[model samples]
Structures are given as structure tokens and as C-alpha cells.
Target: MDFASLMTKEISKAKPSDTKDKKETGSNNKYQRRADVEAARIAAYNAEQEKLQREREEKAALKRKHEEDELERRREREEKKRKLAEESRKKREAEEEAAERQRRKRLGLPELPPRASEEGTPVPEEEDIDDEELIKKLRELNEPATLFAETHKARLKRYRKLVKRSLTPQLSNGPIPTTLELVPEKDMKIPAKIPKDIDPESRKFLFRQLASYFTMLLEEWAIALAKRDTSVKESFSGRQAFNAMVQSRDNMRPLFKKFETGDIDHTVLEAIVEIVHCAQERRYVDANDGYLRLSIGKAAWPIGVTMVGIHERSAREKLHESDNKAHIMSDEVTRKYLQSIKRCLSFAQVRWPPDDLLQLMG
Candidate 1:
């Protein structure tokens, strides 16, 4: 019985040790499960972070591409606008230049380029270069080497012309040059000075208006003159004579009667004579008296007329009156006389009339 009881106690103690080992094993398994769950949660977080980062990078790349495309389009638009503006400017300039040329042509003046006078480049001298060198230079300037069998002297002249053309760039496109003599400004025609009381701008305006009026008168006279027959200019009954009377404001007979009766105003006669005198070129002679002497023109003169008094030299002198001369005039003489007056009036406006010479040149 005692042996059996001891064996039972030993078995009981062994059972307790086994129970403690099983409990320890269960605690270890619980700890392992918690570690595995934590690892899985951390891994899932890392994957989500990576996915978000990739999405953000893709969005940034798309935004940059859109911005670059927008910039490119904007640059293209600006370039097109600039080109159009440049073309418009060039077209306007060309049109203005053409109009200016036409105006100068009508004025019987040279068509000069814009700011031509500002270019002070000297013309190349022909004497400085030989023919071979000159030919090369001409080619460089896009000019012909020589004009049809031109002489050496002619070539030199041509070279000078080319040099002048190159230097000026704005040479006038005028008709054949006139043979009119160039008078010195101070010694030739003196411009009328502005009176102290006169407004300069107003005077200038009046002068321009008067000039325009004179141009109209010239056109009217030209139309009348065109009808005149060239063959019988000297005949009293010729078309030329008839047209001359027709050209006058009224028939000149009344004017002659007024002159004979000494009834015409001095200002009216002076104005008439002043207009006629413009046809003839005269120099300013400091020594001469105020009276301008008259010489008979090609027209047949009336009998026994020594001279026709024109300008009033002083207060006592009366011009364009028949008080001191023969009053008879045929249609032929009258025609030429009126024509001379018209010629004077037809002359262009000049800046040489004195301030005191009112209505003398307008």
C-alpha cells in the first residue's frame, strides 16, 4: 500500500510539470502571432506610400508638359503678330513714298528720296580710278559698264553721274531742265518781309491763298491761249488777236477809254502792270530808279508812241494812263499787250516780294 501511494505522488508531480510546459508553449505562440500581424500592417503601409508617390510624380509630369505646350503656342502667336505688324508698316511707308513722288512730279520738281539732304556723302571723283577699276565699281553698283560705244570722256561723265546718284540716292525725277538763270537771293528777287503789325502765320496763309488764285488764273489763260491760231498771230482779225480780246476780263476798249480819260485808279493799273511784268526776268539794280523802262515787243506798235509808262517811280508819276502818249491801239497790239500782263501774273509764287509791295506778287 505504501509503494502504491508513493508511485501515485510521483505521477501527480509529473502531471503538474507537463501542465506548466504546455502553458509556456501557449504564451510563446501568442507573442509570435502579434509580431506577424505588426509586420503585415507595416508592409501594407509602405506599399500604399509607394503607390501615392508614383501617382504624385505622374501628375507633376503631366502639368509640366501642359505648361510647356502652352508656352510654345503663346510664342508662336507673338511671332505671327510681329510679322504682320512689320508687313503693315512696310506697306504704309511704300504708299507714302509713291504719293510724294507723284506730288513732286506734278510740281515740275525733282523727286528726292526721304531725308536725302541729310546725307552729306561726297560723290566719288572719276579721276581717281582707271577704266578697269571703274568698270568693276560700276558692276558692284549694279550699273552698266559703259553706254553704247561711249567715249572715254563720256564714260568719265557717266562715272561722275553714277557717283552723284549713289551719294544722293534721292535725286529728283524732273522733266528736261529749264534754261532759267539762277539769280542770287539778295541780289535777285528779295522776299517781302513781314510787317511788324502783321501776324506771320496769317500772312503766310494769305500768301498761300493768293498763290492758289494765281494758279487758277494761269489755267484759265492757258485754255484761252490754246485756241489761238499760230499762223496769224500778228493780224488784227486773226484767231490769236480775237482770243486775246476774249481772254481779257472784258474787251480792252473800255480799258483804253479809261486810260485816255485818266480815270483809272493808280492801284488798279499798278496791279495790272505788275502781273504783266512777271513774264520778263529782271535783276535788282541798286542804282536804278523805281521806274521800270519798257521796250517794244514783236507786236506792231501804234503810230508815234515813244514809250509805254508802267511803274510809278514816285508819287507824282502816273503809269498805264494815256495822258502823255498816243491812245490808239489795234486788236493785234492789244492782244500782245494783254498777253504780256498774263505772263507776269502766271509766274509762280516767290518769297522775294517786299513787305510794302502789297498785291504786287501773291
Candidate 2:
């Protein structure tokens, strides 16, 4: 009994100490849990902050790239605009230069130097050259060494004029005179004696040359007509004359075709020469009359039909006019040629005054 009682007392004393130790352990555990929760919260907040910072950096970098691209596009546009403007300027300058050259040529002046050559040395003035050098230059230009009764200043002036004239560009064949002489009737007429062995090409070339001279004569006649004092009331006649000339040129095409085939007609050539000669001499009345005669012959009937017994005896006794008509004009190809010549005659009669009255009118 005594031993059991003592053991029970000892257990009762150990129970309080066990209870205190359990309480302390529980408090320590609770403190450790609080500290762990705080540490985890701090780590999560730091991670969130780092993520936000990275997003901000990406946004700033993207904005900077976009700005750089925009700037590059703007620069490209400006460069293209500058290039177009420069090209337009160069084209305009070239056209203006060409117009200036044409104007100078028309005015009978020396052409301006090309843009590339403008920077080169300029031509020396007449005053800059001495007498000996001037004489040498004159010889080179094939000009007279000196003029009779000419002073030094006068000689230099003459040299300058000659040099300037030489500077003008020459035609490939030669310089064409401003005023060309009228083609002679003999030249206009086809040759009487033809070479038997002449080539077709040579004959055609000869015909073309003759046609060109004919055209030149017409141009000279037109120039003379322009120089004359004409009335404004005759403008309609002038227009009609111009139309007739255009039609005549077209009509001549058939004649040219015939000539090309070596079918030479001297009668037609003589008629044309007569008309051209009259026009060149300013004898428009005679020219018009000749044109009418060539266009319409004096024959009453084109077909050879004599007056019958039903006709009056006086008609039978009447003498027939000469049969020198160009029957070729009645052909289908040349029918329109006569018509155009007739129209020209009609206009010429109204437009040109008589030779006697021309001087008074002028």
C-alpha cells in the first residue's frame, strides 16, 4: 500500500510540468507559422513588381521602334519628292533650250551653245583680234583678205559679220538661197530626145526633179501673190484659190503615176509650162485664160459627130475650131485635174487685178 501511494503522488507532480511544456511548444509552432506566411507574401510581392517592370520596358521599346519607322518613311517621301522636282526642272530647261535654238535659227542668227559646252571657252570678240590674226582667220574662213577703201575698224567689222555668218550651221547639200529663180520653160518641158538605154529609175528620178521644180515655181508665184496689195473683199477668192491649189496637187498624183510608167505627154507639159510662165510674169488674166483653154477645149462635142442634114446649112458651112485639145484630160484619171484647173481659173479672175491696174492698186 505505501509504495503505490508514493508513486501516485509523484505522477501527479509530473503532470503540471508536461502541461506547461505542451503549451510552450504550441506557442513556438504558432510563431513559426506566422513568420513563414510573412516571408511567402514578401516573395510574391517582389515577383509581381519584377513582372510589372518588364511590361513597362517592353512598351517603351515598342514605342521607340514605331517612332523610328515613321521617321524613316518620312525621309523616304522627302527624298522621292526632291528627285521628281529635279527631273522636271531638267526637262523644262531642255525644252526651253530647244525652243530658243529654233527661234534663233528662224531669225537667221547663230545657234546657242549646248548646255554642256556653255562652260567652255567663249568666242573671241572682233576687237580682241589684231590685224594680222584677223587676216589669218579671214583666210581660214575663205573670206577676202581685205576690202578696198576700208579702214582698220571697218575691216574688223566686216570680219565679224563674215565670221558670224560662217558660225551658222550649213545644210548637208549646201546653203539654200532665200530667193530661188523661176524654173525655165525648157527645163519644165520633158526632153525631146530621150536616151534609149536610160534606166526606169533614172527616168523616174528625172520626173521627180521636174516635179520639184514645178512645185518651186508654184511657191514663187504664191510669194509674189502675197507681196501684192489685195482687197479684203477678195479673201473668199483667195481661199478658193488655195483650195484649188491643194486639189491640183492631188490631181497631179495621177500624172506623176503616168510619168513613172514612162508615158511622157509633151502637150500636158507645155500647157503647165505656159500657165506657170504666165503666173510668174504676174499676168494672171492670161494665166486664167490659158488654164481655161487647157481645161476645156473649144470643141463643141468630144465625140466626132458632124452636123446632120436636119441642121442648118450655115451650121454645116461653119469652120470647126482646131482639134489641139488634150484628150488625156478627158480620161478618168485626169478628169479631176481639169476640174481643179477650172476652179483655179475662176478664183484667179476674181483675186488678181489686171496688170495695168496692179500698179495703181499697189
Candidate 3:
């Protein structure tokens, strides 16, 4: 081959390679421009989306703020309406009260009592009120007449409070809840001891309440007797000789036996009431004691002597005049009996109006 021909062939091959490299470079430049354009478009789209989201958030915040303002305004308006209604109600009440006073004056009816002092009316310190009435009022108030160791003045004040509370239906119907103490069962073991930790004051208060309940039971018994036998009168009596009279009476066995058992059932209590009623009426004595030779139960304990006698040289000595007729049982046996009686008084269940008590006598 000629040298020129060889150079020409090599030049042609070199030219083709260079053209291919230029074409590749141009293609790469075009791809890079497209990538840049895509990146710019992605950035712009992201920015636009963020702007829209920000606008939506701002709009939501504005709406919430508007709603909050509306709620606040509504609350303020409601409060204002309530205040106005309250003021109007007060005005109406005052007008009605004034009209009532005028009407009372015109009708010659007794007007309402004067308002109490600004400091409040002071209750009278009178202790001369009837005990029955005071106690009855206390019972109605669901209060213990002897709850606290208060002075006569304080007691009177309590009574006044009861009266005031009675005016309010809610307070009167809703009785002051009192807790009942569950008495421990009497035990035979080692002379059962009351726990010292038990509050004595509370025990005493409970006993005081129980005493009232017992008295109520007695009253119910009396009422039962009245219903059972209309021939008897309600008269209070205390007698020592009656015990013998009761023991001697053949019919008294069943009734007195119940008391001995300390099983205070309605039937027994009712029977006792009848017995007491008959004795007070002098029916038992007249029916029995056929002859003077017959002594009912150990020559019949002494009769015709007044009890609760004042002993000589005692604090009550000056309180009573010397009367030989006045009788007293100061022996240890009598003292023990008194204690038992006191205990009995402290323990009584409340069952009133006969039939109701009959259901719960035990």
C-alpha cells in the first residue's frame, strides 16, 4: 500500500471516533439539563404545596379563633341574662311580700312578726317549760333532748333551732342521722369486760337516746292497753307493794316471767301495761286477798309508805321536812335493785303506736 492511502484510512477512523465522542457529550449535556429542570420543578412543587398547607392552617386557626370568640361572647351574654333574671326575681319577690303585708293589714289578720335583730334573736333562758312538751319537741326534731350536757339556756336555744328547722321541709323530713351502738352480747366468760378504748361519752350519749326510746315503748304499751281495754285511765304511778301484789296474782306469772327472762316482746309488754293499768285502778287487790290470814308472798312487803324518802343528815335533808311516814329502802339489796332498774331504763327499743311496736317488740 501507498503511505498516503494508509494515512487517509487512519484519519477517517479517527474522525468517526471523535464524532461519536462529541455526540455522547451532547447527549450527556441534554440529560443533565433535563435533570436540572426536573429538580427545579420538584422544588417549586414542594414550595407550592407547603404554601397551600400554610394557608389551610392559617384559615383553620382563624376559624377556631372566631369560634372561641363566639363561645366567650355567648357565655358572657348568658351570664348577663342570668344576673338580670335574678335581679328581676328579687324585685318580684319584694313586691309580693309588700303586697302580702298590706293585705294582712287590711284583713285585720295578725301581721308577720318583726324581723329579728341583725345579730339574731336571743332565745329565752327559761327552764320552766313543761318537760313533756320540750321532750316531745325534741323527739319530733329527731334530736336527743339530753344529747349534750348543756345549760337550760343552751337547751332552749336548741329547741329554737328545732323550731326553725321544722319550718324547712327538707331539714324536717331529713332527720339528723344518728348511729346506733350495737350492744355487745352478754357473755358468761370471766365476767365480760367492756373495752376501755370504747368512748365512754359516746356510750353515755347512746344510752341517753335509748332511754327516750324506752319511754316511747312504755307509752306505746299504754296505748295498746287502751285499745285492748278501754276501761283504764292513763295515770302515772310508782309503788313498792305492787311487786308483792304482782307475784301473788296467779295470772301475773306469765307476764312477770317474760320480764325475768329479759325477753321484751310486744305481747309481754302489752300484758304488763294491762296489769299496771288494772293495779292503778285497784282492780287486782279487790279481786284477790280473800282473807287476812293469807299472806301473799312472805307476809306481803310493807305497804302504805311513801318511797324516795330523804335520809337523815344528807344533802337533801334540808330539802324535806322530818316525816316518819316517809319510807326508804337503803339496804344493799335495794341498791342493787336500783342499779338493775337503771340499766333497764337505759335499754329500751322504740316501737310505738302498739301495732307498729308489736311488729318490733323483741
Candidate 4:
């Protein structure tokens, strides 16, 4: 092969190699550009992902906070309801206790002395009284009617005259005498001035007869009170009705004062009043209309006494019932009753009688 031809072939070969090298370099450049673009796109995608992740985390935290807040609110509402229920339960029990105490008191049950087994028993650690000393004290206090026989006889005569005058039909229109005397049992004597119509047996009746009449009067008064009616009429003669009312008010002053000061419970007062009224009538009064009608005389007294006893027993039983069924009374009701009673006692001047007369009055 000629030298030119060899040179030409080498040139051609060189040209082909140069062209291939260029193509390869171009491809590498294009690849590098594509790689750069891809890198930039990847970086952008990564950054966007990071932002999206942050946003998702924030959303999850917000959801968690909202759920926590809702749970807290629900818990607070339940707690409030529980507290209200507890308070209501306590109030009801107090009212029931007050009512029971009043009923027992009104029925004339002996004022319940503190129990010996309770913390405040009055028993001494050792006995201090001797049988001999007790007998001496009793003997000293005793005195026979014989010591004043003559004075007693005169007094008895006067008492009989007074009683006769008081009971006489003619004297009914007149005012009752302020002072009264008692007749002695020994003076079974009829007065010289006794009416011709008077029987010897009737005249001989002593203070026992007067006591019986007084008991009858007491029964009548109790019946009137129970019925919420006055014994005296609007046009009745003299001030007897007024005087009786005044006396009742005076007797009940202590109780009224205690109620006013909130020292006494209202439930107790109401129960006592109801019991007394029922006992007086020898029957339960209609609570709705407040009506009571009782028969008069000796037989009624026994009935009244029996009814009073029943009331007292019922009151004691109620105390036990309340304790066993504590949930029955709502605390709110109990508190309301207590508060109402306190206000009524303080503002209203209602009378309450002495303990000694409670049984008789009923």
C-alpha cells in the first residue's frame, strides 16, 4: 500500500475515533445534565417530604390535644353530678329526725333521759346513799293531815261551796272566780246552807270530784286545739276564751323561743303537734281538712291517754326506720325542711305547752 493510502486510512480511522469520542463526550455531558436535574428534583422532593411530615405531625398533635380536652370535660361533668347526689341525700335525713322527736314529745312520753350505757350516764363510780338516810329524808318530808284537822275542815267547807257555785246552771253566765279551793277527804260533811235538792252523797263528794271535772275540761280543750278550732265563740260572754289563749301562749313561750333560735327542729314540732291533736281527739285527725271530733267525759280520757301512748311508740319506731332506710330521704329535702322550720319558728309566734301538761292536753 502507498504511503498516501496508508496515511489516508489512518486519517479515516482517526476521524471515526474522534467522532465516536465526541459522541461519547456529548452523551456523558447529557447524562451529567440529566443527573444534575434529577439530583435537584430529588432534593426538592426530600424537602417537600420533610415539610409534609412536619405538617402531619402537627395535625396528629392537634388531634391528640382535642381528644384529651374532650375527655377532661366529660370527667369533670361526672364528678359534679356525683357531688350533687351526695349533698341531696344528706338533707333528707335531718328532717325525718326532727319530725320523730316532735311526735314523741307531743305524746307526753316522759322526756327521754340519756341512756345509762351512753357516754353521759350520771351513775357514780361508787354508791353514796345509805338505806337508813333515805328513810330519814322521806320521813322528814312526810306530814299527816291530822296536824291541821280543824283548818282543813274549814277549808273543805269553803271549797265545796265554791265548787257548787261554779257548777250551778245559774252561774254559767257569770265569770269564773279567780281563786279556787280544795276540799279535804275527811270533811265528808254537808253544809247547813246546802240546797234542799242537793243529795247527801253528792255533797259529800270531795276534791276528787273537782279533779274529775278539771280533767273533763282539759279533754275539751285538747279536742278544740286538734281540730284547729277555738273553744270560745266570737260572741261568747266574758274573756274566758281570751284568757285561755293567753295562758296557752304563756305556757308555750319556752318552746317558741327555742324554735325561733333554731335550737329546736321543725319536724319535731310538727310531729309533736299532730300527735297531741290526735291523742286529744282519741282518733287521727284528717290531715287535709284538720277536723277532729271527740266524745266528752271519763271514757274519753282513757282513749286520749291510749292514743298518746301509741304516738310515743310510733315516734320511737320511726327513728329506727329512718336509720335503716337512709337513702329514702333526699338531702335537699331534709335541708329545706330544717331551714323552713327555723324560719317559721323565728318569725311566727306559735305557742308550745310545758312537758307536764303534754299528756293531759292531748
TM-score of each candidate structure, all chains considered together: 0.25, 0.31, 0.27, 0.22
Per-residue lDDT for 38-138 in model 1, tens only?
99999999999999999999999999999999999999999999999989988997888888888889998887656444355434674556779878878
Better of 2 and 4 by lDDT: 2
RMSD of each: 29.0, 25.3, 25.3, 33.5
Candidate 1, position 319, lDDT? 36
Q: Give the whole-model CA lDDT for all candidates, comma-separated.
A: 0.51, 0.63, 0.46, 0.43
| Candidate 2 local lDDT, 1-362, one digit each (tens) | 69999999999999999999999998887666768889999999999999999999999999999999999999999999999998999899999999999999999999898675545444467346787988898898888888888866777778888878877743221111212222454555544334557686656655654454445544544564566556732688776655556666577566545544557565565565566556545566666666666766555553455656785644443245545564445687767755654444444444554566542211
Query: What's model 2's lDDT at 36?
Result: 85
- lDDT value for candidate 4? 0.43
Higher-lDDT candidate of 3 and 4:
3
Give lDDT tens digits, candidate 3, residues 1-362. Answer: 99999999999989988999999998977666768889999999999999999999999999999999999999999999999999998799778878889999999999867546557555555634665777787887788876567765567668977788767533111111122222322211111122446485643433333333333333444443445332233333323323322222323233223333444433223332333232223344321221111111122233355345565433433334332111113244323322332222222222211333222222
- Sorting all predicted structures by lDDT, with the top scorer first, yields 2, 1, 3, 4
**Candidate 4 residue runs with Cα over 4 Å from true position:** 1-35, 108-362
Q: Which ten residues in a row have the lowest lDDT in candidate 2?
A: 172-181
The candidate scoring highest on lDDT is 2
User: Which is the winner by TM-score between candidate 1 and candidate 3?
Assistant: 3
